[model samples]
Target: MVAADGGTDRASALVTSAKFSEAAQRHNFEAGWLVRDPWRASTVSDHFRRLVANRLFVAL
Candidate 1:
């Protein structure tokens, strides 16, 4: 979950969901979802590098 200033909030929510739900935990880990704020260049750059290195596609 990536948003301008709400990335942490969104990620936290997902984490909470996974914490309580077995299906959510499996899907979350399998999907490898992460939170990144575009304003944070370093984090975004790191995510981009990982994606490229893994040959992964961004859903959005």
Candidate 2:
């Protein structure tokens, strides 16, 4: 079973409270490309850019 908001703690809390089991389960997290507000694109892009900027870059 896959939950859309599974990435959030609230979803996990609800699932646990419902007695849903994840034991021996293969997990996958996908950022669904279904943002309602179109303006979220710029916001998400900027956030990603900032995150990458803060990371140390190494050249091999």
Number of the top candidate by TM-score? Answer: 2
**Model 2 lDDT-worst window of ten:** 11-20
In terms of lDDT, the best-performing candidate is 1
lDDT of each: 0.46, 0.37
Instruction: Score every model by TM-score.
Output: 0.29, 0.35
- TM-score: model 1 vs. ground truth: 0.29
The regions of model 1 sitting more than 4 angstroms off are 1-39, 57-60
Question: For model 2, how does the per-residue alpha-carbon lDDT over 3-52 read when each residue is reduced to its tens digit?
Answer: 23333433321112223246424353323243433245444544555656
